[model samples]
Target: MKVVPLGDKLVVKRLESAEKTAGGILLPDAAREQPQQGRVLSVGDGLMLPDGTRAPHEVNEGDRVVFSSYSGAEVTIDEEKLLILNADDILAIVR
Candidate 1:
């Protein structure tokens, strides 16, 4: 299945967390936190402005981005975790 974000929204998949510590100790799932960084999978066209024009989004698909930790809605499709968040929730794009 494919996901397409609506206006001003984005479909992102979180990047994998570190599996091991610096000392090479493997970290269990219970010790890991949900990642705040993700890769953009799909993006909405843009936001509609009051002047009846569309404002282009700052980030595009395939861009790695950092977002607010508590933002967005999560969903699972075919066991794949994904997030749907507003473009505004994105803090920065990874270079």
Candidate 2:
């Protein structure tokens, strides 16, 4: 399934959390924390402006990004989990 975000909205695929700790201790699924980082799967055209123009987005497809912890809505498409969030919610792009 393909997803297209509209009006500054972004479609992100959350990166997988680490399975083991720094000490080499394996962590269970229940003990793992939800990752706030993800890859830019799909990007919206831009934010709709009142004057009738769309604002450009800084993030692009294939760019890894970090977003707010509590931002974005989680959705499941074709058994794959994804997140839809505003461009403003993105903190930084991973190098």
Candidate 3:
């Protein structure tokens, strides 16, 4: 399905959590923390500037990003989980 975010919003697909820790110990579902990393699926048009020129967002499609744990609204699209958040909610772009 095609998704288009409006007004500086971003659509991201959450990455799956690791099944085990660095020590190779299995982690229970309830013990796992919410994922803060995701792949950018869509980005909205640039935000309006005071001078009337739109300032484009730094993020783009396919960019891997990290966000606040509580950021964005969780949504399910076509049975696939996705997040919808404002661009300001994204903390950083992963290398």
Candidate 4:
């Protein structure tokens, strides 16, 4: 299944986090925090402005980005978990 976001919204898939800590201790699933990193899957054209102009998005498909915790909505596409976030929710793009 394919998802096409609209108006500065993006479809992102969360990247998996390490299960173990730096001390080589394994953390239980309940003890793990949700990952803030994700890969951009699909993007909308851009945001609409009141001036009748659109602002281009800084993010693109296949880009790794970091967003704020508790940001965006979660959806299940074809049984795969994905996030729908606004462009403004992204904090930084990973190099």
Candidate 5:
């Protein structure tokens, strides 16, 4: 199924988190933290302003971004986990 976010929302898919420590010690799933980084999948047009003008988004689809730990709402789409976040919730775009 195809997903198209609406009204300043973004559809993002989380990237894989590290499975090993810096010292090469492998960590089990129970010991791993939820990933805060994700790739932009779909984006809304823009936010509506009081003047009825739409603000352009800074990020685009395919951009890798970082968000707060509890930023977005999680959902399962097409049997894959995805996140829906507001544009303001996205902290940074990874270069």
Candidate 6:
């Protein structure tokens, strides 16, 4: 399925969290925290400007990105979980 975000929204695929601690201690699923990082699946065309020029996004598809923990709306597409967030909610583009 193809999803195209409108306006300044972005579509992201969440990265799986670690199943163990740094010391190799196994952690239960319930103890795992939601990851704030994800891969950009799709980006909106860009925000419209007053002068009719669109502001391009710095991130592109397949780019690793970090966003606010509370940002985005959870959605399921083709039985796969994904996130839809605004561009402003993105914190940084991981290198």
- Tens digits of lDDT, candidate 2, 19-94: 9999999999999999999999999999888999999999999999999999999999999999999999999999
Cα displacement (Å) at residue 61, model 3: 0.4
lDDT by residue (tens digit), candidate 1, 1-95: 88988899999999999999889999999998889999999999899999988899999999999999899999999999999999999999999
Q: List the residue pairs that clash in candidate 1.
A: none
- Please list all clashing residue pairs in model 5, or write none if there are none: none
lDDT of 4 by residue, 10-70 (tens): 9999999889999999999999999999999999989999998889999999999999999
Strongest candidate by lDDT: 4
Among the numbered candidates, top TM-score falls to 2
Worst 10 residues of 3 by lDDT: 46-55
Which pairs of residues collide in candidate 6? none
User: What is the lDDT of every predicted structure here?
Assistant: 0.95, 0.96, 0.92, 0.96, 0.95, 0.95
What is the per-residue lDDT of model 6 for residues 1-95, given as tens digits with 9 covering 90 to 100? Answer: 89999988999999999999999999899999999999999999899999998899989999999999989999999999999999999999999
Kindly indicate the candidate among 1 and 2 with the higher TM-score: 2
Which candidate, 2 or 5, would have the higher TM-score against the true structure? 2
Pick out the ten consecutive residues of candidate 5 with the lowest summed lDDT: 1-10
TM, every model = 0.94, 0.97, 0.91, 0.94, 0.94, 0.95
Candidate 5: where is the Cα deviation over 4 Å? Answer: none
Once fitted onto the true fold, the runs of candidate 4 whose alpha carbons sit more than 4 angstroms away are none
